[model samples]
Target: MKTELVQTFGSRFERSLIEEIADIGTWMEVPAGETLMDIGNYIRQIPLLISGVIKVLREDEDSDELLLYYLEQGETCSVTMSCCLGQSKSEIRAVTETDATIVMVPVQKMEEWMAKYKGWRSYILESYHHRLNELLHTVDNIAFKNLDERLMEYLKKKSEISEDNNIRNTHQEIAVDLHTSRVVVSRLLKRLEKMKKLQLHRNYIQILDL
Candidate 1:
């Protein structure tokens, strides 16, 4: 655990802080497709990613999910941080995009570390800044971009984050993340395939152009 913590956060976090995390934080290994967090769940801990990726999403009025952002190694969920500090329920959902390892930091220690560890404080603030920018980008994508363009961006992000151009995600899964229907996703995917932008398999997509 110490080694993983150091490998993930060594450069930015103080050694003492890293040691503290290794000692106190609960180590967890989650498989792909696992829901690490869900909307309305109590937020008592914030996860520090050690490996793999987590996609965060927000639910709409009809309970459809819209992708917010992806959290990668060494990064924590800013929304989780806010909810933890406020002692409120989680507003967004976090799911593992692939097999993942993480350290769960108890929210009870947040205040102590904020006052005691400059690195921790900076990390929290910086996470907020970064996630805020991502939220704005999501807003712009929704407001200004066409569905096809948004779909391409979504595929690009999935490919890049998982480092696999041959994405094994189902059309219905993609539709859920994009806040659309399976029929719409299937139609758009076939259109993209006709344009030679991608290859649509029985259950997966292979990126050919974009």
Candidate 2:
């Protein structure tokens, strides 16, 4: 648990808070494709992801799991402050991508720890601020930038496979990130492919001819 927490959040804190949380934390082992939470569920506890990745999804009124963001090991599940402070329920879903171990700290227990331990308090506060900044960056990117520029930047930053004239990113994943329809992305890809700027293949995209 200590190693997982340290690996995810970084090891700048002393051992006391980690030890304390470990004492009360309940271990949850979840299987792949499991939906941990649905929209309108009040997640009173926070899951500290110890292993594997969870997709954080949101749905439209039509109830589709439109992928919002993903949380992997070391990230906390659910942006609960919106639900915690305002709405009674969260419009979010957490789906497991692999067998995972999550340490669930009950809200009351977390509050108690925060009050009693300065280190824990500091960590939570810092984590919240960091998440807030990330949210702001996303908001700015979506609101201020053109889609093409945003797409390019997102690909450059998030694409795992990149070479001088090629990048590999999944179309479905890019559409989710771009908050656009897959058809739109497909059209754009075709245009780029026609220009000899990229090539879209099964499960992968390649940049071509620079």
Pairs of residues clashing in candidate 1: none
**How do the residues 1-210 of candidate 1 rate in per-residue lDDT, one tens digit apiece?**
998888888888999999889888999999988999999999888899999999999998888899999999999998998888888899999999989999998999889999999999998899999999999999999999999989988998889987889888888899999999999999998899999999988868999885
TM-scores, each model vs. reference: 0.96, 0.73
Best by lDDT: 1
Instruction: For candidate 1, give the lDDT of residue 140.
Output: 99
